[model samples]
Target: MGSSGRRQSRRAVVVATVTPLASILGSGLLIIVPVLERTLGALAVFGAVAICAVAWLIGTVIRHNVLVVEPLKGAGSLDRATLLLGRIADATIVVAYIISVALYLRIMAQYLVRFFASSAPDFLEPLIACVAVALIVALGILRGFRGLERLDRVSVVAVLLLTFVLGAVLLFHDGSSLVGGDLTMPPVPRMNPLEILLVLGGIVITVQGFETVRYLGDQYDAVARVRASRVAQIISAFIYIGFVAVATPVMGLGTPAGADSTLLDITTRIAPWLALPLVLSAVLSQFSAAIADTAAADGNLRGLSRWFHGPRPYLISGAAAIAIAATVPTFTIVAVASRAFAAYYAIEAVIAMRTSNGFARKSFYAVLALLLVAIALFALPAS
Candidate 1:
């Protein structure tokens, strides 16, 4: 490849590798976070998100660029801090993904309840949520990373702006509501640390795409890519925190909130104008996330086929999408997706611990242990 060719290839690779991570994070920052702050209390949400941000910048972004590559000859650790910070991002994302899903369980339960109570549940729209999850997973299998990253450039911004506008409108109309509440919030023992760990396990799905950089290998300007990814991850973390920070107070007027009463719930009650559009946007977020997933799955499968020197990757990969769609019933898909995500993150954290630098392995293990405990606690009990 010529110099121009190499640069173009590199850009394409990075974008593909990074996009799904961005999309997932963007969705979290927007639609789900308002409730995160409102119900949890701004300070608790802020604190956890802040810790998450720092954890990600240090762990995943730095790890791959520096530590993962360093096992090869001639690559220096991104600096002395390489091993320590790198593991933090890995654990943070692993934990975050898990928690995101655990939180979603409440919403899924509500929808199921509603469906049961409704007279014409059979007439319900085909499971858009299921379609969304299968599409996302298939995208991961198909698109490699580049496809997802491209989707994120726009999808992330769209979700963010839409969410911000909806949130801002609520604050503008109901400024006084925010001040009337007690700053302190009683904790949901259900969402205690162990459960929180399980919930964050789904958040692991958000950071899944960053692993794409491993394929970039010798082509990347290692230090620079690490820096860029870390910056992106940190900025995303703070933005998520800030969003819930603003949203919770704006929605504080309602009956005490539950997991179902998150940012979207509060908005629907307080600002119908915002709610109507936002509900649509939430669907868009779901759809967009699914599209990106399909794209990623397609690319990955194609690459694997090539790596194994197999024939006609396109056919097999294309079929993979169809297969996912066919096998996973569209209606229960979101719960399935969330559950799958929880499982995936739990596994990833364990892998991260095994792969992390010495001291940081402890951090990864701590989170990993908590997730296992949560599964036994919440899921096993319910079953």
Candidate 2:
């Protein structure tokens, strides 16, 4: 490869590894932890996180190596009905990603207002977040993949470092109010099989964005992409464990009244000084995730139609996503994102089973069966 080609490949690796970390850190770890604790209990939440880490690693490896088919590919080879379904499924993935991004931004905005500017209007927070996301998405469209990668590199590192520090502080803090018990070790939750299944379904938000690599075309070879994804998932798993370890012990710390920003709530109780950094990291991660998702959406759309085969398409898709997000309720967005992921996984499993050889084929089928169970479990109301 030429120097320019090498640079693009390197950028592709960084974006692939770090882009999903934004979502993993933002709403998935921060906002979802407390909710999981309250509903499914901490044991179930931890089990789900563990299951997701393993499942994502296996599923990603399979998808990258054998099932590397882009849903909209083979348009001429497939029958009309199958091709149409493929397009619709790919389209759903794009739209589901946007909804997830919008939902995370809305949550991040609430934290910003609550912590930094209590006097700000309720709509103002989300509006500002929407504008920031729009600008980031616009930058990706204008500067292309390299610019987005550079931005994500800086933001993901900062968020990861800040998150680690925050988790450590909570782990070591001596304050009775924050620690609430012996400082030697925090309490651990016990997991059951059923709750584990529930968590398997719930972890879609954390692991969903990694699949965007399928849209990257030939930017990186399969081996490199799989390696990068494994590295990313490891880092993401550690971060998830760190936050869950810190947050679960303090589950008794009061919820943040109306908003769903649980990690923020815990930080406020234990270490008020860290609140600003957490908020900044959360917001930054949301921005990176939104950019990555919009870029993926743009790439997918470009695959399906000439009308979407240019830079402007990214901005259009992103704007539409933001508008839909701003208009829909957060719960509705969550519902759409979860269902879309389940459907996407099912479709991908079918594709993988066809392409994979003996051992790999069996593994794909096993994963597919688990995915079905997780999908069904994920649809149930929290009890």
Candidate 3:
């Protein structure tokens, strides 16, 4: 290939990676600092690493399936049991996407409302979220998502730039504070080991979007999709760990009443001038994520059922998100979405175990499947 051809190939991979990368960081980057600081305090960075590690392991399973089982299924070689499992996995992921759509818009609504009125009524957040969902669904129905899909690249680039800038500024601030003998780690509420584990499990949703690559087979070859998934996970893991490490020490001493906007507070304290930019990034990230997941859910539904063709899936997802946004607490929505995705991952692991060869690989998949099941069963919302 010529240099231009190589560049285009690289750009295609990057563009393929952006969907999952944006989905992974979209809402997680906004809420992780407060959630980790409140739960793990001085150990927050380590906790972030642990979550990323789990996410990486799960991503490995997904990549394995992409390379192994996908071919078998594609060739119509899978047995009835594995095919049944695949159907269930598809449905599970669709549900997860719907819940995530709610979680994203809810967080976005919090940032939007709080940006305008610090003391807005509780109802306003959900109201804004529902309205946004309506608009996205209407757009999806009337025009399709070709235009809104561009936001994935825009939001992902803006977020990566803003996040690195914030991390650098925070690290500089921390260094100056430490040099001046003024650095202090924030206090956190102590939790039992079980509680801690549950909280971590609940956070799986934060790093849950890598599976988006599995459904992109139409756009890219399996090799490209697998490569993109791995790269996205690696990049997101570093971003999550580094961001958490720098921001944890400067987080508020206790859980704020509203955890969704915690990053805004930290940014305001560290760099007031960056607050508006951060909020703008937050809005972009959240809305982009919601649109991605909404589209994914719609696609999955169509794949699973003939009845879900056209705009029906979009209408269903929009209605479900609005209902959840109105009825569920933000943290509770996070936990529920986490469990939903964990369940989907657990099912995918089973498919991997069944299709992949070798005792060692099968054992690994079995163990990971059990762990994911535990997470699905036990993950608790952060307080």
Q: Considering every candidate listed, which one attains the maximal lDDT?
A: 3
After superposing candidate 2 on the true structure, give the runs of residues whose Cα lies further than 4 Å from its correct spot.
1-16, 19-23, 42-45, 48-54, 61-89, 119-121, 133-146, 174-200, 253-260, 309-312, 363-383
TM-score of 3: 0.96
Structural similarity to truth (TM-score) of each candidate: 0.58, 0.77, 0.96
In candidate 3, stretches whose alpha carbon ends up further than 4 angstroms from where it belongs are 1-8, 254-261
Evaluate all candidate structures by whole-model CA lDDT and list the values in order. Answer: 0.45, 0.62, 0.89
Q: Count residue pairs with overlapping backbones in model 3.
A: 0
Clashes of each: 49, 0, 0
Clashing pairs in 2: none
Worst 10 residues of 2 by lDDT: 252-261
The residue-by-residue lDDT of candidate 1 on 209-231, one tens digit each, is 34434334455655545644555
Model 1 misplacement above 4 A: 1-21, 34-58, 65-67, 70-126, 129-151, 170-175, 178-193, 200-220, 250-262, 303-383
| Candidate 3 residue 15 C-alpha distance from true site, Å | 2.2
User: Residue 153 lDDT in model 1?
Assistant: 61
Worst 10 residues of 3 by lDDT: 253-262
